[model samples]
Target: MPEKFVVVGAGPVGSLAALYAAVRGYHVELYELRPDLRDPATTPLNFTKSINLAISERGVNSLRQTGLTTLVKDVVSSTTPMKGRMLHLRKQGKYVREAQLYDARGKNLLALDRTSLNKTLLDALESMPNVKLFFHHKVVGVDFNKKLAWFERRTPSDPSSRGTEIEISFDFMIGADGAHSAVRYHLMKFTPVAYQQEYIDKLWCQFHVAPSPKDGKYRLPPNYLHIWPQDEAMFIALPNQDQTFTSTLFLTRQGFSDLDAHPDRLVAYFQDKFPAVVPDLIPADELVKQYNENPHLPLITIKCTPYHFSSSGVIVGDAAHAMVPFYGQGMNAGLEDVRVLFDFLDQYPTDRAKALDQYSKVRTPDAHTINDLALRNYREMASDVKSPLYLLRKKIEETLDVYFPGLGFATQYSRVTFSNMPYSEVQRRAAWQARVLNCAVGGLGVGVLGAMWVWGRGGGWARVKRGVLLGCCWIARGVVGVVRGWE
Candidate 1:
């Protein structure tokens, strides 16, 4: 008989995990706290529309590895490709927009509806005979050493009412429950796992920009993720298959309260800051309706060590590392955990304990690094997106990438979004590139100072200019050569 594999949380990550185990001939049972999301009456996320997910290479590769190539293609086909970040800035009573490509090599992020993607995975799992999905079965406890788990089933007559508790045994269990995971909470009792969680001061509220009333086309360009960067708050919109955009407004708690206190001020504030959005994409009345109706949700960051318990159970996805959504890597990272976990299993099929230990040791640093990156990107997305210096640095990096292809030059966004490079390694490399840029600027500064001194001497000014230009050329060539050599 094949080993019994139990998975908690039937979200995308858990559904994918169940699919993987079923493919390996395991008798897989997937449990969820809620009813089946495919039901038309049942909502997946609390919001009417899901927060958009950007499916990048890391997520795509993980899905492809499942041997479900057609599923991957179908999900990808449903998405809108975001080739760049379209920045919206207000100046002198008018809005000016600029496009910043994610990668010079033409890589793009696919904007996917979270609900649709989860449904796709869940539907795929339903088709497999070896996989059984048990909805409304909430995992209440786990005994890691005994390899036994307990669930509180919802009464069928009244789904809100609690039913009897039952126990199930598993050869192995996977937990992709989410940030407030009961599995992770219970696993802590059986094992000494260090954990940390914090709620950022900012909260996010959802908004919607309907398609053009005339022809039902996109109000804004569909090819980019639109961003309006205010100093203390930000608004971003991602396109959907229905031609509308899901907009999220992020602000501090105090800011949200201020808006709540004076509702009329909200329209005036948007007029002054995010000009043209009120009457252009979303009408003034509709904007107010969304602002009043939608809930303000907190953003949390979670970090933990030793995401497993003695080879019997392991935590993946948000349960392992829940990060804020600024970097657009939360889902991608979670899906990656599934891929990485199975890679270790494939390596140590017999010694599962060793595989689990190795996975915790190797994956923790990358997870923490991504958490930090997400926090940092929140600041960049809200404020730095409008900075001239930030834009200059972005242009310089892209220029180097275009001129020196052999040097393997890339921006931080490209490394994080366009490639599957390790997150920790990407952090380290980006720091090195910053230092290189700083040194180059320092050299130019020294050259200019030296030229000024030569002019003061009243004789060597021409020679000094020539020398400075030559020195800059030499430094640029050397930097390119050094970067290429390192690669």
Candidate 2:
């Protein structure tokens, strides 16, 4: 049996992977390219102006599998429950808000700080006896056949200096080192790893909105997330524990350039479109400087196959499937991979090698599905949902729900968010349901017009009832067709 296992990267996902392996009795050593993040004196990575992440049932259910609910709960305690998407609509000069609940009785997902979560997981890993964290170690190479890792240790010699080369070897290894993973590059030499990377042109810069200050506690109602929708460009805000709101402005490359050209105009644009959020929440000068100055990073997705090193090692998290952040499931999905992996290991207790092999195959499909879905959702969230056709369909579904209580909850968004259905399966079912609804509505509309034309000549009440019955039968037939396809 392999004795020493090494985990590359010490982000939340990698740390969790290390924690899981350690708990399962693997002696794990986790290597991080950056210095110890737990050290208060260390300068932080300029990753993003602190962002808020959402966690739904898929993520929560998996986190609970580690029997680490209390540990997760403690870190996530200050989080706000967003019952559903609070869609923001702009018309004329004002904005309108609507609540599209994810479930029938308003089951909510969670929103909290990414930093707090990473710190919490890091603390847990540090507390484990089987886990050893090596920070400031840059992974330069990985040898799958020999199970060796190459790194350069970084430490400030004086105030303007650094450290030297270091190499470590283990019995087994995992490539949780992220999109440009060195481990993955080396492993692909042995395994025919199918890999793809796509760079999305969309750029994002984040800013904050301070909560109203009274004696101390938050002045704004912290429950719901805030959004300012302008079709092509949008702003979204989620509350934090310190009574401050972290907000992100998502815009296209062209849009970003336009703002960059006339830097001072950002305040003017916000004052016109999202007037309520500006001036008071974020001052004009500060907002504009952030918009023109912050480096707008392109979102990228990376996917790889057979994420392992021979029979002794494996990979998880962003290294395996790097997804766009639009779905708010990137980290959540990574965390889930750890849970799924451990479950597989437990099931194949005696065949650890086979378990690793199967784990990669089973998880990759879902990762690809969600990566595409997440990118598509950006369109739904920012533009398509604001269209007239979109609103009309939503109106139709809502009207149906007045009589058919469960029908609205059967809407596509609900299935994606509230139900534990597969992402691809949810899209497939929703499309099938749409066809059925269309056919029934068409048949009913035609029947009503025909009856009105005939009944204009004073037809008997029995004739009117007969027409209605026939129309209802046609709709029922369509519904039956949909139900059959699902089975």
On lDDT, the candidate that comes out on top is 1
Cα TM-score per model: 0.95, 0.88
lDDT, candidate 2, equals: 0.74
Candidate 2 lDDT tens digits, 1-487: 4378788888777877787777778888998877666688767574345356887776666656666657758655857787666666666766667666555556777887766777877888888888888887877777777777788777733322456877887877877887777777878887898999998878788886766654555544566766666767778887777877788888889988887798677788788766466676777787876666666777789877877754667888888888887777787778778887888878897787788888887887778887888888788777766678877776666565456764432666665555556666776777777877877987697678767866987887777777777778788877786657753
Clashing pairs in 2: none
Instruction: State the displacement of the C-alpha of residue 215, model 1, in Å, after optimal TM-score superposition.
Output: 1.4
Angstrom error at residue 351, model 1: 0.7
Q: List the residue pairs that clash in candidate 1.
A: none
